[model samples]
Target: MRERPKIKDIAERAGVSVATVSRALSDSALVTAETRQRILDLARELNYRPNVSARSLRTRRSMSVLLVVRDVGNPFYLDILKGVEATAREAGYSVLMGNTESDPARETEYFNMLRDGHADGMILMTGKLPPAGGWSHLPVVVALEMIEGAGLPHVQVDNIGAAREAVEHLISIGHRRIAHISGPLPELMSLHRREGYREAMRNAGLDVPESYEVRGNYLLESGQECCRKLFTLPEPPTALFVANDEMAYGAAYELRRMGHDVPGDVSVVGFDDLYLSKAFYPPLTTVSQPRAEIGHVAMELLLKILSGAEIDCDEPIILPTVLHIRGSTAPPRQ
Candidate 1:
């Protein structure tokens, strides 16, 4: 078997001290850029790999971060994942992903992994903290959603204000009877969005009847079912503000199945302006979230915490949202 090259070999070949090679490999700012590059090139030429296990045992760090999200299948999370992986790799760290599917047991298992030093820190998109009490001391950053009372560093858009803007757009298009299909009530983002919807209606002097609000599980089936229920009303809503793009797609699909012309019969608006939203029959008018930026900022915050940097938990990082006017929304027919 061919022997693996060690750091000493790279240092000797690059004509640098072992300490300089170590600093360069770890991407330390202390290392001169030119010297670092030379050492890196020689290391690559020698096919040298760092002893990660030895480093972990010595430093008490796994040199990896974990990201726990609620639904890994959602396309909306793809951009976020990309941002996380990119940033982590640049920082000389690895990322481990966990999909909790809203299951507490799964979430707890991931938290346990963090505690066991499998990861140096965690970025949570699940919006729920671990049931275990020891996690407070561990480095964690919440992303794309907020957890009430957790006092953790969070990265997300202003969901309430964004939802209000979406609903307000529907109203601007002469949609007086606007209905909202919200995400599950337990989720903080869902509640913020629902509140935004109601606020917009109240500001416009539009009466939001009890029947206008429906709870969706942030799933396509729930969106379809909610739309069906809304359409059954004697005076159905002419515009819909769905909580997310997937639900918006489902709502549009169900609308067509029931003989409704997309923007002609009922203008539709969605959140999360996912990549597929533009390719749907009619492009969806929706709120565009900075998904990748949110992920990047969240991971950055987690890295800061892991480095013992102080973060003000009182002020959460809130990114802005834009309303993309697309073909799915138009002025209601007279």
Candidate 2:
């Protein structure tokens, strides 16, 4: 028995053309103040509110931002999401979270949603960006771990430098036999961090032996398994440089279970200082990244692009990392 009023209804009531009503509602300069006021009054009298979806189609924007990540459960991503959420909200925009779980198919699905105009902009913080042939059509902003050739704006920490810093810190503490627990192959972020480890080893004139490094899946179990393998080495490393804090925790736990004293028998350093790192029994010494700031800046850049402002797509804002010295690291046992 009732129908929702359309722009046409407002136009009819305001004694103005549909185009004038549209311009007035959008606050375009084409509509005079008198006409805008008249339309506004009529619209309020009719209890009219502009249809967001319909207006989005007309303006080619949804006023929404998409945050694509691998695993939302990981606490590392939470800070970034919070930053994005706060900044986006302040800018009068909403955010949509997308979990791709490092799956190419799911990443493509989210991209499709953005391409179809479900979101005005996107910040990809996961490893799920389409490999190739998926760069042609993209959202207004793309922020993720470095993609080989994907031409999208992003903000990232210097993974290589940060990893190297952690390893080097151990080296400086007299750890000549430093081992590395790396993530799976082809994970750009992991690979970058691994490279940093390698660079540190080389600079120290130490041979990065095959036995001294192990490939991990960036999981707790992987760390435990790799630790066991490392322990069996004829010349076990005195210190281990783990890829992430989560894996480091597991490795250290396993080492203690195996009757090895951490920082006494085997020192360990980790990356991406997670919240639990500090509260653990011996407080993990790891690299502290500005997680929230990265997300905040990425969203800020996307908002600029959405507002039709020019942006330097090639420029990368790499934030610095801090090495928080804790009890997990010490001079290799003499």
Candidate 3:
């Protein structure tokens, strides 16, 4: 077997001193750009990989970032994971996925990893704030979801605006008796989306009877249960605006089970157009946020923080959302 290529070999082949090669590999400003490029080119040609463990001992950086997700099993997180992984690799960093499963204990365990230098930084998708003290110095970025008053850098979408637009789409198609299936009310995203739903309803002069809104856990089961409750109302809703695609799938599934044709008997809209949304039965109409972009941008922001750049955490970086009109929605039957 060929011996692993080393910086020593690149140094000899590039006709530079080992010290110069070292500086060049690190991209230290002390090395001229021309010399750095030459060394880098030679390293690439030789497949000369850096000894990360040795470098970590010298620099005290694990050179990996942690991505803490509320639930790694959720399909919604897949795109974001791709984005994060891609960006991290380009920057010569590896990623650690911390699946907290929404458990405070697991979250704290991952937080300890960051504090202990197992990872250089963290991109938080758990939608929860860290413990109050000793976290002021950690490099952390929040993604996809927001934590109000957390004072951390964020990469998220306009939940309220996106949700309002979704509901507005239903209203445009003559859906007056519109109901909402929301994520857990305690979540800020859910609250913002629910607010958007209410705002659109209020704007259209529609009375949202208490029965028209149901709290769901952003799961298919909750969507099914919520849909059952809503249809039992004295005046069933003509349409539904679900907070996430999973719940929307559940809602649509239940609608079929109850002998209703989607968009003919009732229209439905969902947020976060997961990959499955396009292939699901009737192809759900939903709001599509830049899920992967959210991960990419969040990782970039964390990298900036890790590089000692002073990032202002005061305001979040908000991305846009697109409302994809699909077969699940249309003009509501009068």
Candidate 4:
């Protein structure tokens, strides 16, 4: 019977140490790309297969990562999930998804998975942390949203800056009366975006009335509800800056139902430009978040953490955002 190829065989044929072969196979960054490629090519030629189960037993690692998100159904997170899954697969790790829907018990269960070593680490997108187990000494990466004072590695876009830019766009188009539809306040993202909205309005020498800001649960229905309350006001806004594209879509739908023309009766701006934003009736004007990139980076950061490597930078990795000015926005009607 022929013998199965082993790491030792690859190392011997490639003239590299067994440790180098191991590191390269594990996708360790310590190995140079050239060396890793060479090792991989040799491994393929030799028909070498990794014994992940044996390795996991030796390292006492589950060989898996946990990705917990607030809402699995929201397309806002679809690309992020893809990024994480792809990166994990490349690094020879499996990803387990937890859809918490911002539920306390569900979140705690996922946290327990990490604490109990069912997974090596976690990438947390839910705004709140575990209520009981706590996050101390846990390997966690915050993605899409930052949990202030958690002091963990985070990957996200500058919500305040992005929101400010979206709002400012409305102002630039001669919108004097602009309202904001924000997401839930508990999430730092929602607050930061609202802060940006106020900042832009303040900078433009405009007043933000208490009624001008309405909070939603980052859902389509809530956005529709916000529009209902806003449009009834004695002085309804000529434009709106919604915290997310889902809510923005809802606002646009409701406005049309209410007999208002998008960008004709009311201009709209949205954040987290979801995929469908561009294809909508009047293509949405929105802030485009690097969803897939954020996920990919967050997973990479987690992999580094698991590898016991010191991250090059201790600060949160902030990705850039772009504003897509499309058919949804124009100068407010006279």
TM-score of every model versus the real structure = 0.87, 0.82, 0.88, 0.94
Best-to-worst order by TM-score is 4, 3, 1, 2
Which portions of model 3 miss their true places by more than 4 Å?
1-48
- After superposition, which runs of candidate 1 have C-alpha atoms over 4 Å from their true positions? 1-51
Highest lDDT: which candidate?
Answer: 4
Model 1 lDDT, residue 312, Cα? 93
lDDT of 1 by residue, 51-157 (tens): 77798888788989998988899888889998999877755679998999999999999999998988988999988887766777778898987898887888888
* Clash list (residue pairs), candidate 2: none
Candidate with best TM-score:
4
Please give the lDDT score at residue 264 for candidate 2: 88
lDDT for every model?
0.89, 0.82, 0.88, 0.90
CA displacement after TM-score superposition, residue 263 of candidate 3 (Å): 1.8
Once fitted onto the true fold, the runs of candidate 2 whose alpha carbons sit more than 4 angstroms away are 1-60, 140-144
Candidates by lDDT, descending order: 4, 1, 3, 2
Q: Write the per-residue lDDT of candidate 3 for residues 260-289, one digit (tens) a residue.
A: 999799898999899898998788999998
> For model 4, what is the alpha-carbon lDDT of residue 139?
91
